[model samples]
Target: MATSRRVSRVAELIKREVSQMLLHDIKDDRVGAGMVSVTDVDVSGDLQHAKVFVSIYGTDEARAETMAGLKSATGYVRSELGQRVRLRRTPEIVFQEDRSIERGNRVISLINQLNQNRQIDDAVAIEEVDEFDDE
Candidate 1:
């Protein structure tokens, strides 16, 4: 079993190597069709497996295509990782779509909208209070 610190370091290295592969080494047309980024990586305690979270910006069709491309290139990516990072055994790579960023943006937008509405209500309440004071 690996310590948490070692596992985290491995995860970071994996993320970096995979990101570089996606940016320069990968030649799949489908992957190139959209903008893709490595968002995070989670590695097992035993360091036998790693889940790579990726965020892609594009239409639904393009996202689907990019995922397919990633899936098909998994073996290649794993091989590249083994070469880039030295370890007793290279962890298996699993690609996952990360939607946390999108969800966060949506939440922020809702919050902003609510704030604007509250400001409008506050203005109306102040006007009512002023009229009452005049009376």
Candidate 2:
């Protein structure tokens, strides 16, 4: 078992290395079809497994291809980590598609739409009050 600090450090390190791999090392054309970013990494307290959350920006087909490419490259990524990192044993890597960013954007758009509607309602109410005052 590893301390929480050590686990977090390892997770950060993994995230950085994975990002580097995506930028320059990964050669899969499918992965290149989308804009891939490592959103976060979750390391088990035991430090034996890691979940890598990634956000891919593209059309649905492109995202699907990118995910497939990532899944196939998992073994290579693990081997690279084992060689580059000084862990006693390399943690197993699992890639997960993160949709939180997309969801957050959708929520923000909805809020903005609601705010615009509220402003319009307020303006109409003010106009009605002015007419009532004149009568």
Candidate 3:
């Protein structure tokens, strides 16, 4: 059984290498104008399958294009991995769009909106209390 730390380390290495390859090696036109970030990687316990989580900064269309490009280039990526990493077997690669960044941004926006609304309400309430005191 692979230790959690070992799994995490391998995941990090894969993410780094894959990101570099996407930026430099892969020459796919479908990968549109945007920054691609490898958010996370999940390697199976047996180290035969790898799920790569990527975050693309752009519209949904751009994200889809990038994902398609990645999927199409999976074989090359795996082969590259086989050459770069000293592993018994190069794991099959799968690309997935990470929505955690979007979710986090939404949460932050909502929190800011709530805080602003609360401030406005508090100001109004304070004015009302002051008016009553004056009366």
Candidate 4:
């Protein structure tokens, strides 16, 4: 089993290399159809597999297409990793779509909306109290 530190380091390296490839090396039209960014990477303890999390900004169809493109290019990405990183055995790559960022943004928006509504309700309550007090 690889140490946690080593695994994390390898994960980061893979994330960086994959991000570079997406930015410059990858030429798949489907992938280029959407704006994709590498969000995170997870490597197994044995360093035999890696999951690449990507956040794509676009419609659902575009996102799906981008994922398919990434999946199709996995072999190329893995081969590139073998050349860029000096590992005894290059890990198998798995592309996963990450929607955490979108979920987080949605949660934040809901929180803000609730806060705004609460403020408005508070103001109305204060006005009612003032009217009763004036009676």
lDDT of each: 0.96, 0.97, 0.89, 0.98
Report the lDDT tens digits of candidate 1 across residue range 2-105: 99999999999999999999999999998987799999999999999999999999988999999999999999999999999999999999999998989999
Mind giving the per-residue lDDT tens digits that candidate 2 earns over 1-135? 899999999999999999999999999999999999999999999999999999999999999999999999999999999988999999999999999999999999999999999999999999999999999
Q: Candidate 1 overall Cα lDDT vs. reference?
A: 0.96
Model 1 vs. true fold: TM:
0.96
**Against the true structure, what is each candidate's TM-score?**
0.96, 0.98, 0.95, 0.98
Residue 64 lDDT, candidate 2, scale 0-100: 98
> What global local distance difference test value does model 4 have?
0.98
- Residue range 1-135, candidate 3, lDDT tens digits: 688888888888999999898788988877655568889999988788899998899987887888888889899999999999989988889999898999999999999999999999999999999999999
Best by TM-score: 2
Instruction: Give stretches of model 2 more than 4 Å off.
Output: none
- For residues 1-135, write the lDDT of model 4, one tens digit per residue: 999999999999999999999999999999998899999999999999999999999999999999999999999999999999999999999999999999999999999999999999999999999999999
Worst 10 residues of 4 by lDDT: 26-35
Model 2 lDDT, full chain set: 0.97
